[model samples]
Target: MKIAVIGAGSWGTALSTVLADNNHDVVLWTRREEQAREINEERSNYKYLPGFTVPESIRATDSFAECVENTHVILLVVPTKAIRETVQRLLPFIGEDTTLIHASKGIEPGTSKRISEMIEEELGDKKVQSIVVLSGPSHAEEVCKRKPTTVTVSSETEEAAERVQELFMNEQFRVYTNHDLIGVEIGGALKNIIALGIGMNDGLGYGDNAKAALMTRGLAEIARLGVKLGANPLTFKGLSGLGDLIVTCTSQHSRNWRAGFKLGTGYELEDVLEEMGMVVEGVRTTKAVHELAKRLQVDMPITEALYDVLFNGKKPPEAAKQLMGRVRKNEEELASLFLGTGDSDRS
Candidate 1:
């Protein structure tokens, strides 16, 4: 199959390699001409995936039309913030029958829209109809090395999902299929916010017990928000939610985790972001989740605490104290989510 991977970032390049390794003709598109030249000429992306060589069959191009012209499957690997612009630009290039697989992980801040929505906005009601989300706990660092990793591809269209499952699922890369698009998307988006708070806790010198509590509570908050948005609560326990949270919180390879680690170690937000030299999806997701909780009226105490620490000038340890001092309630109290979102599920 001919595969087109948009975005020259680590994840994009890694997935392109997977396709190429499988003997699929792959064209990776980079917005920057220099990055495209490096991929096509030098056979490497030292700036993004250092120590990784581009496969000879995995070519690069700056031309979006050429990349998507005859492609069988396309992977949208750009940052969440760039999803709108990228898809809008790719509209004219999309074949009417093209099947899309979005690997971007984010929810739009104010609109609370996922990347798939961005795609739909661009494509409108075109006859070409396959859409799938591919996400998991796997880091690009591990995936680039062909380490064992598992992820899921979800689409309302089951045949499309299974087609993608057959495309990328190898011995080292396991793929699961699901029909819950909303659940998979929300699960992938919210975990990053928890990762930021986890980083802050580590910076405050919190022990494993505190980290575990934060994770447990964060998962609940994530599930609450997801359920309100019409997502299946079970998705939160799957690879895209709990699995992603664990990896993002604990893995040193995670930019969100490292960004949080720096903030936890007392660096200012600007300095930490500047030094990290990568997109920390969690920081942006944190702001969005805070607004979402208010809009939905969910009792997301951990999200609130983290938001205070991230935006309201609260110290990490102080934020911890605030959480500990809050009037505790039944862990299964479902009334909080019921208030605004009108979700019928009991806590």
Candidate 2:
């Protein structure tokens, strides 16, 4: 299969390697002509994936028409904020039979739409075979090294999900198919918020006890929002849910966690983003989830606390203090809220 990966970031490059390794013809698209030349001539994307050699078989280009022409699949890996414009630019090049897949994890702030939703809205009457989401615990750094990694792909149809699974599956990269697109997307997007909070906790010198608490409770908050949005509760326990949460919250490679760590250590949000030099998705996701939770009446305290620290003038320590002082309830009672078995008053 000929695949056009519409982004040249670390994740896009790593995935292009995977597709090339699978013996599929891969074209990687970047907005910068210089970056394309570097990938073609120097075989390195040092700005994003330092010290990693890009596969010789993966061709890079700046032309969307050249990238998407004759391609069977178009994988969207750009940032959430760039999704709309990217789709609009690439729509003219997409084929009627093309399979659309997105690996970006984020919710648009005011719209609260997932990456797939944004793509569909941008697509407008242009019909595609499928809109699939590729998400899980896989990180670009580890993937670039061909380390063991697992991720989930979901779509509205089983055949579409299985087709994506076959396209990317390999010895080092395992792909699983899930029918619950809503849960997978929600889990993938919201996990970054928890990772930011966990990063802040670590930055503040809090120990493992606090980290464990935040992770556990943070998952509950995720499940709450996901279920309210029509996701299956069991999906939250799967790869795209708790699995993604655990990896992002604990890993140093996570930009969200790193950004939160900087914030916890007393750096301003703007400074943290400028220093990272990459999109720390959790900052934007925090604002989106904060608004979604409020509109839906879902109680996501961790999201709210992180939002206050990130957007409001609240300091990290003050947010921590507020989180620790909240009136606590039984864990199972909270679990029941998402399980759809709890009393209405509990919600």
Highest lDDT among the candidates is held by which one?
A: 2
Write candidate 2's Cα lDDT for 48-128 as tens digits.
Answer: 999999999999999989998887699999999999998898788775688999999999999999999999999999988
Instruction: Give each model a TM-score.
Output: 0.93, 0.97
lDDT of each: 0.83, 0.92
Candidate 1 regions with alpha-carbon error over 4 angstroms: 333-347
User: Top model by TM-score, which number?
Assistant: 2
Alpha-carbon lDDT of model 2: 0.92
lDDT of 1 at 341: 41
Cα TM-score of candidate 2: 0.97
